[model samples]
Target chain A: MTSDGSGFRAIPRTAAQTRVLDAALTLISEHGVSGTSLQMIADAMGVTKAAVYRQFKTKDEIVIALTERELGTLEEALEAAEAEPSAARARELLLTRVIDEAVTRRRAVATLQFDPVIVRLLAGHPPFQQFIGRLYAVLIGDPSPQARLPAAMLSGAIAVGVMHPLVADIDDDTLRSQLLSYTRRLVDLPE
Target chain B: MTSDGSGFRAIPRTAAQTRVLDAALTLISEHGVSGTSLQMIADAMGVTKAAVYRQFKTKDEIVIALTERELGTLEEALEAAEAEPSAARARELLLTRVIDEAVTRRRAVATLQFDPVIVRLLAGHPPFQQFIGRLYAVLIGDPSPQARLPAAMLSGAIAVGVMHPLVADIDDDTLRSQLLSYTRRLVDLPE
Candidate 1:
């Protein structure tokens, strides 16, 4: 597959930019993008709003950067999956990695993935769309009307599975295994 | 099935309260609970902030009321499922109804269900906790730890399934059918 438009390459962030994104993501995960302000992020970092602004001029820019950072975590897995010869093996490899990441950020996954502002950002931004497209390609392995629902459901299941209150008390190891199994069931992949 | 903690009864709302909730839900769905304000709700309804204060004193009440109102939409179905003699039959009934509701409110479902503010409220609030307990009782039909992951995954799959970008373009009827089928698979229910 061509790397162009695939979002296979990670966006590089300067150390200062990384620090700004780190603080912003914590607040955004708790308060959401609209609820979070550059001032709050600055305060969280013990820096001035202008300092935060120096890295990201607007809240939307910070949000986009945060999304890119999150997506960057999966780039390696996505690339490895794409390189695999067998579709089933490719999906298995990607899903295990996805589940691991989801479990690691159980509390933040839902907000990061489902918050209204992030949802809008993901839909409107071409880079985010390209990244998601690449993820789904490995996920559903089909580009047809029939695959849309399972693809959507699987994505939802994984994102929601990690963060749902019903599973809140579940330890990460158990939650991760469960997410992998149930998501596999949703897509009819072999265990 | 004791009615005391079951949350089977829908919380009633006055006409004015309903107007506040309607306006609040619209705005909150666009901007999350933390992002939405009483003043915004008032402006959306073209009413003074004092007028909104008369109906509900704080933004928390509006959010709680919105959750109750959303749950109220499924009270009848939840009740029917509770009354069903067969466990499998009850799940089928509930899943179909849940799928229908999710399809109907595709855009708002993610925000209402997964927003960090709502998630915290649902977890910490007794009534919401009870309402969700009743829903899960019919959903998993078991209280074991084994059921936790599937329950969480099923809940996530449905909420995310309807609202996820991949399924955004699919028609409601088709989306509903797909959600029901895939969710049933996630829970090992027959199609």
Candidate 2:
């Protein structure tokens, strides 16, 4: 639960908040942010809408929390990459962790990334903007005019690669290995 | 419009149907499939819902038609690629055209590809399935387990690259060139 002067908030959730997020994430995956409602999250948890409201006053809050929680998973990896002495090593460490997380939560990750509501939210939200800035800084270094497209493509490729229907049958291990390899090639990392 | 034996129907849309599809694409880009309604489409088009319904009976049909229309843009490219004698040349031709189309209608293209409702429709609809199969076959040759991930990543990267906020400010020409360069790198295409 802290801000690192980059608008990065590390607010830890309470047990009830955790339950709401877990339920909300599942529903959002199936129904999307626009299709999902607060009531749906409540029903999924076998609770009243009021209970869900107590945890998150609005669907927007729930959406923000769910997104923050997903992004939070990458904080440690970002920090670890920041600690690395070599820029290349930092990029490698962060990319490896990113691929692992994307594969592990393939469905939820893609759902969150591609959902129009969530995409708009992330772009306009200061905290998310800051966190993502840090992420790309670590993954591809400072975004120069030349660097931006590759950075964008790298993130998009990995996210879409894991959840793509063509790769739906790909076991996590094979998918992860191929993703890392192709990702490295994209970013010019050593094989 | 005609269907090749691959279940890829090429039914030509009428003028009124074209207008509905255009309006629906704009709305879908902003609100996504689930959030958009016939009322919204009708309102956007300055018509009654009944009038809109005259063109497309269901939201699902609208979704399918929108998708098919988008895919139709690539039909010429796919045909040219198939006509090429060499597999590598075919892939190059298709990849170049795919990038061109993705860049030309960047917003609508990403919206169609990533929207959960549209994604589901594309997956469940047989014609879309066949068209996409033909698409990937040209762009990546085959769906051998090894080719699937790269194929998926290539499409994802280009789609996400064009629509990504990071590159939003980059003019389309610059964006297109960068995308083409990076995509070539990912697929190991000769520059």
Candidate 3:
């Protein structure tokens, strides 16, 4: 996890860290961070706790790694959004990728937002703070406190819209396209 | 516990049931339905678990009661929206009430979406299902599954946004105002 231009600290990963992260994310998504334990993760992966610990020193570390891995997938998009010539373009580009990634990952995104432990982790970490700022920057495109609600709504919509029990009947292709179209309207995107 | 709407089936509540529900919602919000046992609810209310059982037969009953209490709050607004002559007016009224109810009961609204048992409860219940459908009818104004994403996002933004670590510095007034502003954007409300 390398920092995007925004100086957000993302943990760059090795292949081993990647494997640990994949397993951790799966468990965390379903069971939530508090409900999920390291032992459960090891059992899920058929590994010993010691082996898992070698990859991440603590549950906090595992969470960080998992967050970093998820963010890492968005690194290219983040970079692109930052490099955009205008804020509108940045928001547009980010929204596109957000919808695409959301459709691809679906349930995982919804799960991440609701995990109390992960919520705490994101709150307490400076790098996570910076990364999230960068994320909102692209998501809402303004620093105005006034933008907070729209940003919140946009963020909420992305997380909940794709994975909602309401959307279960929606196919990925339709879900993706409809999400983008509606989101553009929400964000004031030009047709 | 009764179906207030959404696809969820709500348990019918009498006046006696309402007392048990109020106590349960407060406890469950803080502890989560799974983490919140009947002993905890009874302890919180200065009663024994058997006393709790007398009101409701099991933990499932309490969860249904708590959910119904929350959903019931929405029924008035849903009815008002349904009464509206126009889609735009219906969405407007529903949006305002949603923002108000969420802000007034910030903690409950925020926490309910994340609880494992509540999450499951809301999904399986039929009255909840119908209530949710009616609520969404006023909210998105169209049944586009694609349109559903923004609605979901808007819901999430209000529930999680004001409570967000990023926006912690924001006062309640600022949070509420900003959230309302941004949600309008997400739903493409007129400027």
Candidate 4:
């Protein structure tokens, strides 16, 4: 991973940065944080290690940038959730968007989110923590015992639903509708 | 990925197999399915890759054994659920047991379940699919939209709850109770 120092690659105005992100995401997905190297990313991209270094300074930066872009994708939905009239409404809205995003980019969501190394990074980063906190509050409600269990289960289900090995053959449309209907019951939202 | 074909370590026997399973579990949790290999398992076991192969004939078998063992841990609870006279009681029983396992295992359940390669195997495998069908049937009593939504959400929450980098700091008991309470509310189980 190389350093862009821009904190994030400014949307690949150039094809190189886009290639970097695309390659980086797949490698990162396959290799966890500590495991993925610039050489590997470069190899995957059919470029040299230095070629990767030119794109991002260090693996951490690449990871952060990758996360920023991925989270950036969720910004609109998150903003809409924050603006919703009630927590329930916020969750309902987020569920729709979350399902859409997960189904659309099924591989990326699971790989990026579930990577052990990324899991650590997201925890240590304040912005990530805060954003996740907001997301969970909407999905889980107040942190009370009453809300925590369902919240945990609901999130687990969604993460598992689309990517579930069992649900692989279920197709995007079916997965989307099933997830929405199932999670609607989870959060007690209307059909 | 060697296939020891030793059935499951959760059963009442075999110390060496348990040792192997324990090491494999820890390594897989750190490295993921595709990332972890037989050589790694051998090194972890302080044996040759051939020895690891002796326990399991192939990598896929190891994976199946691991999956079976994990599912086996939940078997007694599921059996109780099946045996229960009332559907509501069965649902309550299964959820409680599942929540209990999640809290106890903390990160293991979610991590292994989310790995892409393993997810495929579990789905493609008939026994796993059948077991899960039973699980959902018990968990989801009616196919109503309301019931399906919560079932999906609870499923997401449970997987996310224990392993979530978000809740990593929370103690197991606290996580367990919170998970139980929240999930109960989702299913509208008795407090």
Candidate number 3, chain A TM-score: 0.87
Q: Write the per-residue lDDT of candidate 3 for residues B1-191, one digit (tens) a residue.
A: 34433334334567766777777777665545555677887888888888888888887767666666665677777787899898888888888887777776666676677765567766777776777778877887777655666667666667777555556677777676666776777666774
TM-score, one value per model: 0.92, 0.93, 0.80, 0.75
- Please provide the root mean square deviation of candidate 2 (C-alpha atoms, Å): 2.3
- Evaluated on CA atoms against the true complex, candidate 2 attains a DockQ of 0.79
Q: Judge candidate 4 at residue B169 and give its lDDT.
A: 71
What's the candidate order when arranged by decreasing DockQ? 2, 1, 3, 4
* lDDT, candidate 2, A1-191, per-residue tens: 12353545446889999999888888787767888898888999999999999988888887777777767788888988999999999999999999998999898788889888888877778878878888988888867878988898998899999889889999999998889999997788987
Two-chain DockQ for each candidate model: 0.76, 0.79, 0.43, 0.36
- Rank order by TM-score, top first? 2, 1, 3, 4
Q: Per-candidate interface C-alpha RMSD? A: 1.3, 1.0, 2.9, 4.0
Considering only N, C-alpha and C atoms within 3 Å, which residue pairs clash in candidate 2?
Answer: none
Kindly state the number of residue pairs that clash in model 1. 0
Q: Please report the candidate that would top DockQ against the real structure.
A: 2
Which is superior by lDDT, 2 or 3?
2
Extract clashing residue pairs from model 1: none
Provide a comma-separated list of chain B TM-scores, one per candidate: 0.90, 0.90, 0.83, 0.87
Task: Give the range where candidate 1 chain B is weakest over 10 consecutive residues by summed lDDT.
Answer: B1-10
Off by over 4 Å in 1: A1-9, B1-9
